[model samples]
Target chain A: MTDRISNKKNITLSIIAIIVMLAAIYVLDIVIKPTSSWSNLMTCLEKGTIYALVAVSMNLLNGFTGLFSLGQAGFMLIGAYAYAIFAIAPEDRATVYQYYEGGGLIHFSLPHMLQDMMGGADAFGGTIGYYLGIILLMIFAGLITAVIAFLIGIPVLRLKSDYLAIATLGFAEIIRSFFQWEGLGPVTNGSNVLRKFASYDSSIFPVLVAGICVAFIVLLINSSYGRAFKSIRDDEIAAEAMGVNLFKHKELSFVISSFFAGVGGALLAMFQNNINAAPFTSNMTYEILLIVVIGGIGSITGSIIGAYLFVCCSEWWLRGLDAGEFLGIEADFMSPGFRKVVFAVVIMCIVLFYSRGIMGTNEFSWSGLFNFFKTLPKRIAAVPGKIKAKFSNKKHKKHTENVKEAQ
Target chain B: MEFIAKWLPYILAGISVGGQFALIAIGYTMVYGILRLINFAHGDMFMIAGLVMVYMATVLPLWVSVILVLIITVVLGCTIERVAYRPLRSAPRMSIMISAIGVSYFLQNMALYITGGLTRTYPTIDWLQKNITIMGASTKMVTIITPVLTIVLVIALVFLIKRTKIGMAMRAVSRDFDTSALMGIDINRVIAVTFIIGSFLAAVGSILYFSNYTGIMPTSGSMPGLKAFVAAVFGGIGSIPGAVVGAFVIGICENIIKGLGLTTFSDAFTFVLLIVILMVKPTGLFGEKNIDKV
Candidate 1:
């Protein structure tokens, strides 16, 4: 009964906390213009949310299902392209696909079409229609990606660890190439970048989307299917023995993970206000995997925390280092690439020493926080004594050495 | 005659590039054979070798820089294995692979810092750069030299693996790591030697490869590294000859794809082939199949 009550309380607390966070973000977005020097914070938050979604989806496969897939970038590419192609304004398609004959193909904007049906852009209904249309398009993008993942997963999910990794990586490369191919110029605009799409006006949009998606993921993780996925991760043979249809569960995890990855990719396109196939390389996949690792692998909350920290560090905090001055220390060696080098070294240290990362397969909880705060005084009070004892032990050793010398 | 003339350059280029890939693929195969870990930094080590040669050539003679580059690369490979991989020996396989990736990221960033993200011109040796005509096509001396040199090195390596005591230890270790260790084999030493040999071959491959290309950048090694790894997988991970054959086949097919006016899909073709091969024959062309014991 206590567990149930606490669970209800935790849910209420989390909802309130999310509302406050979103309110703060909305206020900040108004206060800080995009042109401001401190706009990196906004950029980081927006990008962080997107990366968090991708990282969580990756964790679902790698950490929960024991499938080492490196094809997040490919699915994201598909999602981005799917959204970008349809989201492009009809007028802009001419210039966007200028290389193609007859001013490109499929020239109707989904949001515009919705707007027209709801009494045009000046009406409140039209505005609601526009937002709804974008959401629908995002979902459409995700569904398209999920379908592709289902096809790819058919043959790929059967392979073991590293082979799966390479095969998925190869598929990602193939997808990238397909999008860049000149033959697909009519639809994909060849290798040229797709831009001028409908984007969210504020950071609140992505925060809301990513927040809801992560909550869903958490709920899924606590579900029966999630338990089946975990069983497969811990031991495939045992999972099979327990009647967990191995291939079915594996495929389901892959498809679901890919669905969210697609949505994340669409959000990323909105974040950048442009999309291209070239940057979706294996390196991008590595970056996402690293984020998942930095956040403890199997923890949604950890992935979210890790994404923000990674984005803030690389995009905001480390910018000063790249500018040749960090924390008021300016040196000749502190050039453009120095930040990345230092960042890499720090990552290596994390990988080598603190391999469990910030969360270590643990989720954040209100009770855990309460307990920590409850024990804070006692833990802090013992620090001085511990330090004194350590110092005195060293002193005593030195005294013993001196006595020995005298003898 | 027209067809031969038209395709000869692409074929020749394919063989030459394939030879270089084989040299690097051997490193991956040997490392994976014993360690069961993908040494992701191996490619970066190859890149570093090119960068080392570029910088070293400015201060020293070409021949001296060549030797120094080889030594430095070998040292780097061993150091990475020690610092990044050795501590994770008892950890999960994922952690070690992540460590390898971390090392790769570090090396690439280090190179970026040193080179300031500039594409450094690869220093050319006069002999390797000399132009020659083969059949109806003209090419650099390195094109012919690469295959010859690759074959020679592979033969010597094969002999070392087959006829030498160290080779016997390597075979034993790859066959069964724990049993070989319990049977008085110094696992650390054998691993170090394997890294040494791999890095040395990579350094040599870097020299030959850079001689063909115009410039070397921090990220240049990644594509080749990945492709070489694909070759290693194509040939069967643990087999050297398999890696070589896979590399040659992939190289030829890739170039042929480029020649067929599908330049964008050339890189994709390699991956397509990889997926097809993986689906049809998961053990690879020459890979030995192992039965899973539940």
Candidate 2:
């Protein structure tokens, strides 16, 4: 009964926290009217939410299931393209598919189609109906990707670790080229950029979508199924000994993770307001995997923190490392590619030294944060005494130097 | 007769490319055999070898540059093993693989930093570019040269693996990592030798492979490297001859698929083959199956 009460409290508190965080984002964007720094930071947060989702999903497989897959980006590609195809406005389809002259004869808009099914504007009283249709489109994107994952899982789930990595990596490459193929111009718009979809102009759309999806993953991880997956990761033989069906659980974890990756990919597309197959490369997969490693492999909180760290360092603050005119100072050799060099170096250090990463299979504890805050004043109070002692020590040194000179 | 005439050129081309794939696959197979590592950095080493050739051709004559490139690649490969891998010899399989991935990233990004992501043109080889007509199909001299060179090299490698002292040491080491060490075999030296031979073959493969493809990028190695790895798996990973045969089959099938106008999915075709192999055999055509120990 106490456990139930605490669980309820935690849920309510986190929900309240999420609402507060979203409110803060709205205030920053609409009310404060800060400069490019704030705007860039907001963009980073939005992008970070999507990455956090993908990274957490990756963690589900790599950490919990012990299945090292390199196929997240491929699933993301499917989701992004599916969402874009369905939700793109009817009029913009022609402009977007300029290379292929109106995206073939079977063009249809997902939102409008759903709006019609929902009995048009009179039924939901206007644009709300259209918004509901877009949400459904996003869900469909995830479903399509999940179905593909089920098919892909049948062949690939049986392979051991590195073999699985190479196979999935190969699959990603195949998927990328498939989207870029000139012959598929009707459905995929070929190599051309996909645009004018129902994008998340307001940051709330992505936060809600990515947040809810990630929460679902977190809940799944804490369930009995998650325990079974963890057992497989820890000791597959023992897991099998415990009567856990290895193949079934592995497939389930892979498909579920792929579903969330799909949803995250749709969120990413909306954040950027345009989609292209070029960005969904193996490098993207590597980046997300790096986040999973850096964030602490098994911890949900770690992945989120890593996502924010990655976005902030790569997008906002660490921009100074590369910018030639950073802080009005000219640093010539700090060219554009320097950040990538730096990031690679940082990952090497993290992999070598802090392999378990920041969280190390631990979640961020609310009590831990609260306790640190409670102890803050005492540490701050010690600062001035230490400073005074340093000054006195410096004066004593000066007196000793004077005595030496007089002698 | 008309169909044979039309398909014959593709067959020839596939054989030529397959020979190059065989060379690279040998490297992957050897490293996996001895160390039980995928050696992801092997591809990047090949890429660097290509870039070294491009840079060297500008400063020196082609013959000297080629020889110099081979030496540099061998040294680089050995150094990577000594530096990145030797320390992780006793670590978990996961850590070593991650370390290999890190090395690949470092090499690729370093290349990017140096070249600023530009795709550079490969130096033209005049003699290799010479055109020949066979059965109403015209092709370059390298098409004939690549397979001949590959066969000779494979013959030489087979002799080394079967008939030499170092070859015996290599076989013993791959058979059992710790037991061979107990037998007074210099494990480090044997591993270094494996890397040297693998890197040497990759360098040779890069030169001939680029001779046909004609452009070099920072990412040039990744596709061929991956496909050659697939070949290595197809052939039975630890067996050199298996890697060679797998390379040829993949090259031919891939070319035939592309010729069928599914040009967009030719890359996927290799993976499809990999999946099928994983499903049907789990091991390549020649892979030795060992019973798992608890």
Best by TM-score: 1
Per-model clash counts, in order, read 0, 0
**Cα lDDT tens digits for candidate 1, A1-407:** 11223778989998898889989999999999889987998999999999999999999999889899989999999999998888887888888888998657788889878988997889999888888888999999999999999999999998988888878988998899999988888899999988888877879999899888888888888999999999999999999999999999999999999999999999999999999998898778888888888888788878889899889888889988888889999888888889888888888898899998888899988887777777889889999999999999999999999999999
Q: Judged by lDDT against the true structure, how good is candidate 2?
A: 0.86
Of the true interface contacts, each candidate retains a share of: 0.76, 0.61
Best by lDDT: 1
Model-by-model DockQ, in order: 0.75, 0.49
Q: Lowest lDDT 10-mer window, candidate 1 chain A? A: A1-10
- lDDT against the true structure, per candidate, is 0.91, 0.86
Cα lDDT for residue A382, model 2? Answer: 87
User: In model 1, where do residues sit more than 4 Å from their true spots?
Assistant: A1-5, A382-407
lDDT by residue (B1-294, candidate 1, tens digit) is 999999999999999999999999999999999999988888899999999999999999999999999999999999999999999999999899888888888898899999999999998899999999999799999999999999999999999999999999999999999999999999999999999999999999999999999899998988889889999989998999999999899888888887889988888878877788888888888899978898
Model 2 spans > 4 angstroms off: A1-16, A31-35, A112-125, A325-332, A370-407
